[model samples]
Target chain A: MVLAFKNETFRDDFTFSNSPAAIRRFPFPFVEDKYMYSVNIEPHELGPKGSVYEFPIDIDEHYVSEMRDRALVLDADPGRCQALPHMITAQWDMLELLMTSMARDYPEHFSLTRDGNQWHWINRPLGIDHKFTFGDVATLPYQPMEYIGRQCQGDFSIQDQRDGQLWMDAGIITTQADWSLDFDVGMNFFEWHAPVPLAHQAGVFDRALKFLLNMQHGRPVRRLNWTMTINSRLDTSPENYHKWGIDRTTVTPENVGDKVHLRVELQALWRLPRSNAILFSIRCYMIKMRELATVPKWGRRLPRVLRTLPDEIADYKGLTRYRQTTIDWLSKYDDGAPTSLGGGPD
Target chain B: MSTIKSRPIYPGLSPDPNARRNVVVCDAAGAEAVVELLARADGEFAGRTSVVLSSEGLFGKESESIVERLKPATVETTAGLVPAIDRLKEILASATMGLRLYAAGSEPLIGSVVQAGAENFIDPLSVRTEHRGSLKRRVQCVHCKGMTENVTTNPVKCAQCGLLLLVRDHYSKRLAAFQGVCINAETPDESPELKVEFQ
Candidate 1:
């Protein structure tokens, strides 16, 4: 997965040669620094017109209530070990990744609103004497995280729960170094989630478009993920993955960059009859004001200094596009505007 | 971890504060509900709906990477924070520690733990690489157990204590990252913070 880029001048482009992928240090750092914009994608004239579709996500309320009751009994009787409801919430977070990527791709199409996300593993033994049998500790109608929601094109781990969580880390799933479900996320990317205002979504999505365009231009797009500030919301942030005993893993602002291949056969990659993988690009940069990660009484959130994001804000008026090249068309399923462009030299 | 103190379930709390450093987290229901129920006296998580924001309070396994149990939680950012200033002041006014929450999930994505961090550990750079290169190659003696001169090779023997001391990862040969330097042993009388250089 080595990313190759043409521009080596900006801080956003690839700086590390040792890494298999050519990286992008900073693209439009000024925009991110000024307006609080994150990743940026340029318009792709040659890139395929991506398909847009949304899947439904509706969870049952009864299922949540029943399982929650059982979870209480287990925690009440500590000796009678049971997987707590909170562990299910952690699992819920993992399942959200694929779901969100899908939803974001079709914001105008799909809206997943699932309520009562709980899981009760029935048909499984709870205690040695089986005093707390499947139904006693868990209930039906409980929606597991895997059942939370999903949108995939290939044979993901979800096909087999016996192999554990249907997820893979960055490394290969091979023998010797077998089943490395360990994905190396960037350093600055935090584990968090909350309802952010729609005001910021547009700018963020715009960045994604720009990042994808860079990939179409042979500029490798690297890294894609998001974290939300919860101090304003609540202390129970996503990073508190109690199930895995992980507060944080090793990641840096430098690695989120992804090298998207536009010319690659995308249709063939879609394994399902109507399934498709979303195409997106992102540009991550080093923040000047590195706020320390802190824990509060009720919420755990990262710093909210939006001012120190990318580069100089006021200089966009004069800058122009460096070059003008027609894009190579692959395949498009939607009829919406494909290019997210700027007023730079065309 | 939650800063809102709670009495031990069914009985009383830990006699020592240090021993009371473990907490568990649940969802809107279960273990977390108990914390809110128990903290009625302290008025900690009682009225607040954020009872589930504490990572440790979730139905989870406890360990070090998480914040201290019973610690307070707060947003680390200060942007557009004027409105939160009054609220932040109120939380800080209360006594105790806090920790951040990790909630990751998205619209269609089921396992999005948004609060997770990518950093396993981070060491800030307070010194320049060039500045550290000017210092001499100081080594511990492997033979005599003494800080002696004239030894230029790896795994040098001490002249005084006769103890053999091997340089860790001799091939890495980095100047800025000086390892195994007992700055305290060099100057027991001076403050360790002030004793910057081995020279």
Candidate 2:
């Protein structure tokens, strides 16, 4: 079996499975039990009607039972092990489908993770292939990377919606065009959504380059002192991408009585490693949307909120635990792509 | 000269003559978006035409960076580069890191020439109107809204009015005014594509 074959999944289709065996292979999209939380929400006009549901397991229990039947402390069959490539490919494929479905199914609730909070988001079609290096090497400091003017090959996926996902086959030292942010980064989804307007930049990925200027008031917006550090090592800070873009949009006084929303996205690059150290394309997004998104106490609970029907727990034994959350947003939907980061509340 | 317009729907104790020009402390996102909204409305609806995006302090450096990235035209000064209108000025400016969730609800100040929601900012024709009304009416107090009888001296007590007559010191009031650096629209994000090579 090949270690890294390019195509993530067999089909381009978002819905339906090939066949339903007493045991199935691909499962429906879901969140982990450890991460799920109860939220009180009032849906917008275009909100979804879905109840809460946990993420599904792609493996079948019958197979696990079969291995156990072999005895001797559970047979020669590797319980969760499959062809390594098959698992990787399946995960990537399913993630893409899930991202698109989430956008299509729930547009209003679509978001990206920003400023340490969560929100809703939709989907965007992506580029074929590219690869990149981890910015923060334990041994490297105060030194510009030698791979600045280089190229690699891999598919790119950026999903900033509430349930966005990203998967890429990458190499060390390459750059990406698509930007995204607002979600957690794990083995499954590496990059989040890219912020609007700032998606495209003009320089090399400076470890600490200046981004988004003029954050203060009453001065000529100047362009110096924009040094910053972008972290890309999955093992170290696998929660996100190194490079990103942001836009601070607003409601003008002319519009009068409107809320402000900031659209943002995070980006990263990855290369599968050849050493004992595993190559990780890792990260996720989380946003506050605190002001924009209210964890408000509503007058009454609607029958259908952001809830999933409760299900019986499968065994949690031997499961490697992940302990983090992420979020990010779309550029446009109700309005045109965020035209510009204009100022003031109308 | 910009304008100030206040539209407070709720009644208040300090609502008495609240139409004074002032500044607001907007967090990162607040300064950028809020200023744009305020400027646009002041220019379009309130006739505070051409109010600019001015800045000062640490905001200028980054603002300048963004000004260069988004509206590069604002940076040049050769004829075509010259702004037809003026905007607010700042000291420092930079770019947003694509994840500025920290600035959501902070409202900065919008210093207009008039109230936040005034019918007019500066009656450009007012000078002429006052010219027709004579020197006595030209030197009226902006705050007290009364004519300065002596035009030059502060009236301790006036025969025509009971209260002390106030006069505007145009020279002192207009000095140290924050000016705009985006004399022209310059930042153009045509593309910021970074080249990546595989190792």
Top candidate on DockQ is: 1
Point to the candidate with the largest lDDT.
1
Q: Name the TM-score of candidate 2.
A: 0.17
DockQ, computed on Cα atoms, for candidate 2: 0.01
lDDT of each: 0.22, 0.20
The DockQ-based CAPRI class assigned to model 1 is incorrect
TM-score to native of every candidate shown: 0.18, 0.17
Once superposed on the true structure, which residue ranges of model 2 sit more than 4 Å away at CA? Answer: A2-346, B1-199
Look at candidate 1 and tell me the lDDT of residue A87.
40
lDDT digits (tens) for residues A79-163 of candidate 2? 1111122233333333333333343443332222223222222222121121212222232221111111011111122211112
Q: Candidate 1: TM-score?
A: 0.18
Where model 1 places Cα greater than 4 Å from the true spot, the runs are A1-43, A47-346, B1-199
Model 2: lDDT to the true structure: 0.20
Q: Per-residue lDDT tens digits of candidate 2, residues B1-199?
A: 1121111111101111122222222223333543443443333222211212323333557755534432311222111101211212221022122211111111112212111211222321111000011122123222222332223233322233333332222211111111111101111232223222100
